[model samples]
Target: MPETPQLQVQCDAMIGSLHINADFTTTHPWTVLFGPSGSGKSSLLRFIAGLWKPQESHVILGADNITTTPVYKRKIALVAQQPALFPHMTVRENIAFGTESNQAESIAQMFDLFALNALADAKPATLSGGERQRVAIARALASTPRLLLLDEVFTGMHRTQRDTLMQQVRSHCVAHNIAVLAVTHDLPEALEADEVLRIESGHISAQGSPHAVLSEECTAWIQGVTSLREKL
Candidate 1:
């Protein structure tokens, strides 16, 4: 696989009463956008995905200035918190939907990667939440995106399951030279990222290695856990 190119974004936007001004570039294969709810993390992603137009924005992927490109033309894939799988299509079909080639080899790879072989014939309505989320991710990757954006995709998954799935996805992305920018409130998830952007009040307060950027938060979380254990 070729080296993953840098993803650069500079944007200022107002959504509702929140004002967002973020300027950052992703130098690592997997970057985490860490923030509280309503901190404009999702808004920034929307701007980059061409879902929302900011007051002023510039998005560049690799060597191309894709600021004006349409959403479909961006070669970017976003899997939101809600798994939006096709109700009518089977799991296998859903995974194959985004892929242009719909190649059997690639589809089979996704099925194996997400452990969806058992559910291949099942419909969205018949699947568990985690199962659905896995299918959604596999669908996105089937598209073979240059960049993949994840918005709280592991919100309700078990810690062990989330960690395992993330590892698999990261390995797959790295193998394909796909850059990933994921949004999360989970400290453990943030800690796993190669780089992290800590956002506050709709602005980036820090950006660096996860440990360097989130040391304070990590310490507080550890203390909280210790206190809870003592009580129990």
Candidate 2:
């Protein structure tokens, strides 16, 4: 396997009555699946993360075919919208759980990566939403997953907090060449991605640079595109 793995997803499946069949390959360290609500975006991420094994789907990471691979064996981590943290564990302990080894260096790296040093002793109950999300991401990265799947993980965070954490996480993951697939409907989030795939009505309608796809999705709303570009 190469130091930095690339992902190739060639999948076609009927997810519970919603026929989501699409094929695309992404090598970008930070790729975003941008779409509206209930557009089967999360379903695609689930397939890649091994959360839901489609009857006919294959996820190739680097050179390995993980079609029938179990979730734990995939070297893939998923941080959901609502992070399911252990309520009893302290922040530090939570990040340290399920590590492949007692690699203190990685744990220490996470503490700095997500700025979780000060709140090491804090319990999940005491942490705010943004704090919990950051810890969740840090914990996922600590597992040394080759691929990280994020499902609307920054939904409720304030704009500044969300942007800051997203950039911090993206930078760290990109440096490690850990392929990331973030699902979001926010244009800002899509714009931040290195590559963007637009999903509509349960299929990938388009894929390309964020600006090009976003522009196609909103060709009539030219003003909207200009305003969004200004944010970049």
Candidate 3:
């Protein structure tokens, strides 16, 4: 509603001559990079996050062109499929890492926001996959990221767990007005994204609402939504 946050990414990158030219803007708070494995979804995320530099690109967030900016200064947080938590630190410490001295309140909020209160004292080695992911997300949020990159974050969770956590992620992003780019090949995962960009063979095939971009490739989901609408 405020109309402030904006993300624009354009890249002509290559991984071992597997060329990929992607151009897209994240107009919505949550945009999904949906594609099959090896379609360069994760590669694109890496380029945006500054984990990997693209040859020719312009990545702008709000007023800053972060293409050449350092990773920490870009105000972007990436939570990979395997949660990268500090093995030695407790959950509380990990979540408070990016926050400032007034971290007591933020720690409490992360606990409540991600249901991590019960695991506050636990180390990364002792936490389950889902718990680790929750903590990673909390830590990222505590840092006050302007853009969040989620790469296959539901690998270790059950369907119900993934669904619940996804809802939480959406709520958190919306509340903070943080832009999110989620990479996934799962149809159901793409369904939850605010906008969908269909990537195939290192290129974007389509971009729109799920039902719109997926009409031909994913008629089943479209028909399912139609059936539900009819029932309502």
Candidate 4:
């Protein structure tokens, strides 16, 4: 099957009290939005997810213009820093939520691939941070979304856990031909993406392959933050 066309987002929005304007055009399988706090990465992702409106924005998925589409109708899956799983729902229930009846078996297989089968009956409150994030991902994938937005979903994971999840995310996206836009302050994490976009003072300052963008001054600032984060 032909891969789904990657996203094309041009937005101007306010995050908290800050105003942001960003334009991105790329066909990368995985794109990383890299910036420190307050740079508007999360806000942009929220805009794409239909969680927030952009003052003036255009969102095109494949050939359709979904700028005014409602969140549920957008078919976009967002996994935030906090897993946001339902505490009362079992893993199966959470993953199956909003999914078609024919998708249940596929969702179970996905959970098993993530090694979350043992915790299928466990609630989010009782799961570890990594497990919750994994389940959250599984839930998102179960919906067969046209686009996936990941907002620092690996924030507190250990190196091993992070690496494992990253690989799984990449594999799953490729297999499903899903377009992914991930936001993070972690340089190493950003490095795993096929393309990286750097935002600062509410605008896109640089965008390209990870190595290309890493050489720019804005990315240098991001690298400084990443360095300090590693020290902490």
Index of the highest-lDDT prediction: 1
Scored by CA lDDT, what does every candidate get? 0.91, 0.87, 0.85, 0.85
Off by over 4 Å in 3: 1-4, 220-232
At residue 59, give the lDDT of candidate 1. 96
TM-score of each: 0.96, 0.91, 0.90, 0.90
Candidate 3, residues 151-222, lDDT tens digits: the string is 988765789999999988888778878889999888877887889999988888888897787667578767
Best by TM-score: 1
lDDT of 3: 0.85
The runs of at least 3 residues in candidate 2 whose Cα sits more than 4 Å from the true structure, single-residue gaps closed, are: 1-3, 216-232
Name the runs in model 4 displaced over 4 angstroms: 216-232
Report the C-alpha displacement of residue 220, candidate 3, in angstroms: 4.7
Per-residue lDDT of model 4, residues 1-232, tens digit only: 8676768889876666887888877669899998889888888888888878866798888887889999899889999999888899998788888888888787977787798888888888888888889998998988888788999998878988899999988898889888899999887888889999988877989988888887664477788989999999
Candidate 2 clash figure, as a count: 0
Candidate 1 versus the native: TM-score? 0.96
Quote the positional error of residue 71 for candidate 1 in Å: 0.9
Backbone N/Cα/C clashes per model = 0, 0, 0, 0
RMSD in Å for all candidates: 1.2, 3.3, 3.8, 3.6
Output the lDDT of residue 179, model 2.
Answer: 88
